[model samples]
Target: MIWLLDLDNTLVGRDDAFALWAADAVARAGGSGDDLAAIVAADGGGFARKTDVARVIADRLGWEADLPAVVERFRAGILAHVRAYPGVPALLDGLRAEGDRVVVVTNGTSAQQRGKIARCALAPHVDAVVVSEEEGAAKPDPRLLEVALGRVGADGADRRDVWMVGDALHADVAAGRAAGVRTGWVSHGRDAGDGPAPDVVGRTVHDVVAAVRALAAPAGPAPARP
Candidate 1:
């Protein structure tokens, strides 16, 4: 089986490095501890400068703008907080043990995403790392999935043979469905959804791993909302 996993909130909970940087930026910008957060919420640029979250922070602080320099600092915080969610490593290892090919389908730029992978030590276990920054598009985009499939050779296979696991319905689940792959949602350790549901759901990475190990393959149900 080939697994395309999400990073933030999926592998690691959404206690973002951007949020931490925003906290510090807020203080540096002469605002309250929460002041810079508005920019981060509005901007999604990690270290790649997608939305320029740090630039917004600098602007809010009325400081001279420096995209390159601020990106480095912001990434430092992000890498520092690059802690994986509980049981993530176990699941990845288990999948490898099962002779599965695991590829990280994440969004962000070359530097930002690579930093996380390096800090998290993900390269050794996974087969490949695909990020939107390099692909020129983000998830839920079949183009990105196609590129990933080309990398891992998942083409001509049914959705049942592949599993797309993540925490976000709009992003990961939507991407899975778009790519015509099975879906397993790690719903923030709840492992269960109240309204709609996934083919298989896990509250944590470990539960998903258990489901994967028990099931014959990745034939999953539809996705539900939070």
Candidate 2:
């Protein structure tokens, strides 16, 4: 099987990292807890445009830093705090050991996303990494997934053997569906609501791994050519 995973808030604790950065940034700007809360709310769990979030933070905290500087600082802070979920390396290793190909397909700038992957020590585990900025296409656009497939040399593989796993409904699930691949959603303890449904739902990647393993077909003898 070919597993395409998301980077932020999926393999790593992006939300937690952002919260940590937001609190510290707000405090350094002499802002109160309410100010920090407002900034976090504006982040929209990282779905909001980063520039927009930075603008909200600057306005709320009365920061003198320009928008670009604020956004750069925010990116740096998250990179410093982000860490992969426990057992992620081992889980990925197990998948690869069983002849599965794992690729990271994320919607973000190449530098920031690759930095997180390196910081979390996930670079060696995943077979390939695809970032939106590098590919010039983001999720919900099946072309991004196609780029990933081609990167990992699985472009012509059966869609049934491909899985796009992530927390975002529209981006990940919808992208996978459009690409004709199965999807595994990491719910993070929230209901999926009315968005695109996933073939497998789990609170974490580990759960999704288990579900995928159970769903994947067992290896058998090769068919004889007539």
Candidate 3:
């Protein structure tokens, strides 16, 4: 079986990292508490584009640096705060032990996403990493999922054996459904609500891992004791 995972807020605490980074960046820029709040709001939980984020920070903080430099600073701070969620490393190891192929299919700029993946020590766990920007297609568009499957040498015929796991409903779950594969949504406390239902729903990465393990486990009862 192949597991296609989402990086931010799925395998790692990306929102936590973004909060820490944004607060520090705002303070360093001599911005007030309100400025930090505005920056965080503008970040849209890392959904907003980096260029837009940089522009907001620069304008709000009265920074003199160019957009590219501001983006670099933001990226550096975010990377510094990157850390995998608890049990993620072990989960990846367990999946590998079960002979499952893992791939990180994330939506973000190559530099930012790759930096977070490396900084969080996620690279060593997965067989391949696919960034949306690099592939020229983001999630919710089935083509990105197709690209991911191709990287793992999977095709439409193998969709049944593939699972797409992520936190976002519209992006991850929708993408999986569009690609005709099973989907697991990490609810993180919020209800999945009404839409295209997921094959499995879990509150955290560990829960999802357990679900996957069960799915991949051999069926039927044990044979007579020898």
Candidate 4:
């Protein structure tokens, strides 16, 4: 089986890292208590584009730094806190042990996403990684998933054996369904929401790991070969 995993908020706690980064950025700007909250709010929970976030910070704090400098600071801040969620490393290792291929499919700028993967020590665990900026297509777009499949040497013949595991229903889950592959959604304690339900739903990454293992189990010794 092939596993296509989502990077941010799935394997790693991107929101937690972003909060730490916002605090650090606020301190660096010599802003007060209220400023931190304001900055974090303006960040849109890290969903805002980096350039736009930088501009907002500069305008709000009266900073003279250019966009590039602001972006550099943002990346540095996030990199400093990059960490995988509990059980992620072991999960990847276990999948590899079972001879299952794993690919990271993410939607973000190459620099930012790569930084997270490298800083979090995730590169060695997966077979390949496909970033939206590098691939010219993001999640919810079947093309990006196709690129990931190709990197893992999977063709349409293997689609039935592929699974996309992610936290976002609209993006990751939708993309997998659109690509005609199975999807496992990491609900993270939220409702699964309105849409075609995912083939599997788990409240945590650890749970998802268990589900995948069950799916890939040996099928009772292949029915004793008849």
Over 97-181, each residue of candidate 2 has an lDDT whose tens digit, in order, gives: 9899999999988889999999999989989999999999999899999999999899899999999999999899999999999
Worst 10 residues of 4 by lDDT: 217-226
Per-residue lDDT over 81-186 for candidate 3, one digit per residue giving the tens place of the 0 to 100 score: 9899998988898888888888899998898899888888888888899999999999989888888888878765478789999999889999999999999989
Backbone clash pairs in model 2 (N, Cα, C under 3 Å; residues 3+ apart or in different chains), count: 0
lDDT of 1 at 17: 62
lDDT of 1 by residue, 1-226 (tens): 7888887767764456667766776776678645665667655433235337656666677666886676577667778776776667777887889888888888777887788888777788788888998999787776777677778886766667788887766677778888788888877655344533567788776777678667975668878878
What root-mean-square deviation over C-alphas does model 4 reach?
A: 3.9
**3 versus 4: better TM-score goes to:** 3
Candidates sorted by lDDT, descending order?
A: 2, 3, 4, 1
Worst 10 residues of 2 by lDDT: 211-220
TM-score-wise, the better of 1 and 4 is 4
Residue 105 Cα positional deviation in candidate 1, in Å, after optimal superposition: 0.8
Question: Which of the predicted structures, 1 or 3, would earn the higher lDDT when compared with the native?
Answer: 3
TM-scores, one per candidate = 0.76, 0.94, 0.88, 0.85
Off by over 4 Å in 2: 217-226
Best by lDDT: 2
Query: Which residue pairs collide, candidate 2?
Result: none
lDDT of all the models against the reference? 0.72, 0.92, 0.87, 0.85
How many pairs of residues collide in model 4?
0
Colliding residue pairs in candidate 4: none
| Rank order (by TM-score, best first) | 2, 3, 4, 1
Say what the RMSD of model 3 is: 3.4
